[model samples]
Target: MGEPKIRRLDGRFDDPEIETAFMRDSWAGIRVQAALTLIGFSLAWIVSTATDLMYMQDSPYFLPTLSARLLAGSVGLLGGAWVLMARPGSDSRDLPLIVYGWILMSTLTAVIVASVFPTAEATPDGVADVLVFTSSWMSLHVLAIGVALAAFPWGIAFMSIAYMITYLILAVVWNEQSEHPMIAQSVVVVACCFFAWLMAITFSMRARRRFYITRLYEQAKIAAEKAQEFSSFLLAATGHDIRQPIYALDLNASMLEELVDAEQWDKVKPLVQRQKLVASNVASMLSSVLELSYLDNAKRPVTPTTCDAGRLLRDSVSGLKDVALSRGMALHCEPCSARIQVDSGVAGHILSNLISNAITHSKGSRLLVGARRAGQFIDLVVADNGAGMGDRDLFLESRSALARINGGQPLRSGMGMEIMFRLAERGDLALRITSRPGHGVMACLRCPRV
Candidate 1:
């Protein structure tokens, strides 16, 4: 039976499900907003016209003539048309047009009301006229402000300041000598202040939501990348560590059978022992890889130990000697005595993988491992006189096995390299690779000497 596959969560913002949800929500919000705008405008128009008609004969409360009403209606309709028909996507430009249109309509309505209305009877008392004008103006301004705030709440403070200045100028500089100018001015001021406060609160909430969304996006991207890295690592580790030993065991078992057939009883015991050893090594390697993966994912605590780096590299080279010899390659370990503080087992694994990789890819029959000291750091280099990689091959990392190892093509090198890199990263070391076509490939692990 095949191993169960692990399914990862799709957290990308551009995922079909997420995109659909966002679009659905945005469209619903827009439709509702449009409907509300239309309703509000209709109500305002009906109320203003009805009130004017109801007090037609009273002082400062006369109905506008049909011609005047038609003119004002035409202007208001044109303004609404411009707002609704202009490019909706261009909010920055469209917002100004919307606001200006509302202001223009309100001003036109005020003018028509003033012209048709009769003069006040005594002391020019026209409180009703003043109230109608102020109320209409404030209502239109508030609508404009609300729309602006909804579109871009961050800019609400600036909009609030502008609205405040306009309101103050109109109430103070252009004050008509109505009986209740003070009351009209006070109402306008209070309405503008309330709207400004609402805008401030809305902007604050929007900023907080935006911050949280941005943080979530960044975290999701990082998690996706980490998951991809882990998946690649697991695939490579399975191919190299798990499969290789099984192959070795099968080869040794076949050899044992041939020895028994030839009546060479002496060789059977050693062959069986070697096969068992290979199986044990495979198990150990698998355990180590699993542990490393677990530690990386869980951010496990690590206890550092001091060990001899030179001895570790030498042992790693020794272990790969038989493998290299089988492929007609010589694995060489240059003399070095540099001692560094690190996990000996992890260091050995890194060196073993690097040397084995060099042997596998070598075309010239030799792989060299060497180390040198430079100030407070030690640089270990693994070089192979292989049909050396080009710049493209040397820099290639995180590619899949099937994509790389097809029909006798060279096995992918990045899995081992990534493991080496992760080890180096955990140990606060630096790993660098340099290669030239037809010359050789070299990898250096530079770690601080302690």
Candidate 2:
């Protein structure tokens, strides 16, 4: 055998549907942020204004700068409300960037409000205390927003960096004459920002892991449902497979009784053969189902022992030779002497499945079973000279995907393909198929040689 070819990358990354899914996940976060920001802006402004009026009543700058403060709060309100109005399901990729814009606009409003009025010296106690209370309330707002932004880790990071920088700038440039402990404020603000970022990351990981697990559950549910459907299809399609054999057995039973009554010993030979053939058919169908259940349930498997690969193939082929001849086909095993480690019964089952599939579906006149040493492994090859599939996709999907029962190039026993796949996987064997439409198929099973 030659080396396998390297596969090229041809994945669908820029798919439009993928972008839509991304938007759906993000839309919830953006909507929540918008609603909260709008509410926060309204409450922050109303409280600050009412206090400024009561505390700074004597300050000359208070009355004149009141209008400028109102304008800043109004800007934040309008930005939040506007973002909230945009339909959440929209396919626009810039919605996240737009949310960032809202952040910038609010930050700008805060800066403008700061520059509008100077801290008055006359009512230092009243003015300073009111401002201090407002700043404390604002710190709590930052903490609340950090918790809300947990769904979007990147957004939390951006907000944390921006707010930390804003705090440092205000502490140095605006609090020069303030009697408050600016150093303590700076330290607390910086520490809180770091904590917020870590908290959001923890929340994001938990949320994403939960979503991934949910997806796996859905896929498993779908597989179980598909298996049920396949079972139903098996009953419908193989109705003849069961009926024909049973009908033959009934006829043979009647003939066997008459031959015995007449005491014709030689005449009963053909009737006995007919009874055995029909019984074998019934047994084969039931046995396939039983084998499938055994593999699926993860039953304990037998241990492998060193055996002659040549004899295994020869014995399996011999058993199927009569069936092949009945269908006007030929089966043979290539001479091999290489010893390999395998559970002989399981290996025989695998060989029987591959050979039976070839006889039934291969449309081939001849099939050759062979084995050879490849490096440290042994390759069990089943090659058929028959028209393969319309495409390799069907070949690759033989396990989960259904073959057309009546759509038919002899898709006999679903057990043949499905069982082979599961058994190969359980036994830790490497299975590969090589074929095209016009050409035949070669199922290569590779396992370690002892």
Clashes of each: 1, 0
Model 2 ranges with Cα > 4 A deviation: 1-86, 114-134, 174-176, 213-243, 258-271, 294-450
Per lDDT, the best of the predicted structures is 2
What are the lDDT figures for the candidates, one per model?
A: 0.56, 0.61
Candidate 2 residue 237 C-alpha distance from true site, Å: 8.7
Error of 2 at 341 (Å): 25
TM-score of 1: 0.53
lDDT for 139 (candidate 1): 51
Q: Model 1, 188-230: lDDT tens per residue?
A: 6567655754654554345334544665787679977876886
Write the residue-wise lDDT of candidate 2 on 1-450 in tens digits: 222221112111144554345346656765766556655755576557875586456776566445545654675566556667754455554445555554555444444444333354435454345345434543555566567655545555666676667666656655645556466666776777776777766655555445446656776898687567655544543452344345556666777899999999898997687567557646765564444444323363455789899988875565456556656788888999899987665666567667777877788798989987799999999988888744543354344443443364445433356556555665567677666775788887786798
Error of 1 at 41 (Å): 17
